[model samples]
Target: MKKLEIACFTIASIKIALENGANRIELCNQMEVGGTTPSHEMVTEAAKYDLLKYAMIRPRGGNFVYSTEEFESMKKSLLDLKEQAIDGFVFGLLTEDFQVDISKNKELIQLAHPLPCTFHRAFDQVIEVKQALEDCITCGFQNILTSGLKQTAIEGKEILQALIQQANNRITIMPGGGIRSSNIEELDRFVQANWYHSAAITDGSNTANAEEIQNLKQKLHA
Candidate 1:
């Protein structure tokens, strides 16, 4: 069966995602900053849910580019979380020129050690797509969550198709960004991935809205 993972920004939303049948959760602390590494408290708390949880390892918001200290801090964060009995971790790193920072990312991945690693949307910023894919494969990344260089996966379906074809089982390509129940059908029919990710939020501002969460799950299962 197809699998659906939900990107959750807070503890409340993580609970909502789990209650609604999301098979996995990508835990992040700050959604407004795109996403950042979650706290140890949050990670430990999430592990209790019995659902697959992957923590984001971004040190700060801004762009994927990082200073030397910031990159070192990310590695340290991974080392700290490696002791946690969690599923995996997600993050990405790039050079100031928008090229893949292979060395820095490799160091962070090593810090993650046994945990599976996912190269996040930072892959989108690389100037060369095919080269970046090959680099990710070479770096031992398990998956790549991208939108095929488009603002949204739907808008980039053709490129996504090509990317998936090129992947050829080398690594999983999980499309994210702008995914919702309204467009999931078309995505499911077109992408045909083993997994997909969506952020299900409510109409209101704060707190996880129970009704909207349930509605999203229903659509996913449908």
Candidate 2:
């Protein structure tokens, strides 16, 4: 059966996602910057949930590239959380010219140790998407979250499909960005993904749409 996974950027939302039938979560902070490294407290807190949790490990927001200090911080954070019952870790590192920084990534991956590692949207910034996917695979990443180099997964479906074929089980290509209740069924059928990510929050002009999450799960599992 197809599975559904949601990305939760906060404590409240993490609980919501799990309660709403999310099988797994990608925990992060500063969703405004497309997710920065979550605090240690947040990671430890998420550990209490039964759902599998993967914490975002990016130190900052501007881009996927990392400085020496930033990389050091990432390593330290992962090491500190090593005792947590988290299922995995999500992160990525790239060169200034938009290439995977394999050596730097290897260090962080090593720190993550037994936990599965996911290459975040940093894959979107690589100069060559196919090469970048290959790089992540070679670096021993278990998955890649991407929108096929376009702004949203909806807009990038064609490229995403191609990427899925190219990945060919070497690594998981998870399509995220702008995924939602109304569109999830189409995406699930089209992408054949066992997992998907979305905010599914209720705020702004969204009160009437608050029930959309329940509807989404029904449709996804139908």
Candidate 3:
């Protein structure tokens, strides 16, 4: 059974996604810039839901690489959210050369301990996929949300399939980026992923579409 994870930016979006049977929410803000950490008020409000809510811990969105100060800021955000009902954390960091910051990511996984931690699409930034996957597993990240180093999941299906084989259940390789309800079934069958991700973006729209989410899940079961 393939599960759906939607990156929701608003309470309304969260409600729609959840009502439509999205298995989880990757909560964030500033989707135009990829995603930045959402406000405390937003997190507080979204945490009221019954579904699993994974807050984006990124302090900013330009790149995965961070300075010492930025790293500290990420930790601070995590600490602040620890007391909230937020279920888990999603974030990523890389070295100047696009290598996973093993030491820092280990710190991130540890800091978010006892809850699931996911290294986001920043996995696409890594030049060394095989080694980076091992690092993510070693660092205790529960999920790696990636597009298989491509701009979109459909474009990267071959690599996604290879990644799934390489992962072998050690860590979940969730195919995100440009996934839509219309194409999910095809990818679901070929990708063989138990987990899928999307923003539920519709034509001429930037906001999430509940109907699309419902349709996507329905297609998954079809």
Candidate 3 error regions (>4 Å): none
Q: Compared with the true structure, what per-residue lDDT tens digits does model 2 show for residues 1-222?
A: 655566676677666776777767788888778888777777878888898888888778898777788888888888876677778899999898999999988888888878999998878788888888888988889988888788888887888888888988878888887777778778777777656666676574211132655666787887
Per-candidate TM-scores read 0.92, 0.92, 0.97
lDDT of 1 by residue, 50-157 (tens): 899888899887789888798788888887777776788899988888877888888777777778899999987788988888888877899999887888988877
In lDDT terms, which candidate is top? 3
Per TM-score, the best of the predicted structures is 3
Quick one: ranking by lDDT, best first? 3, 1, 2
Tens digit of per-residue lDDT, candidate 3, span 21-139: 99999889888888888788878888778999999999886988899999999999998898898899999889999999999999988889999998999999899899999999989
Candidate 1, residue 211: how far the Cα is off, in Å: 5.0
lDDT of 2 at 68: 81
Q: Report the Cα lDDT for residue 133, model 1.
A: 88
State in Å the error of residue 126, model 2: 1.3
Clashing residue pairs in candidate 1, if any? Answer: none
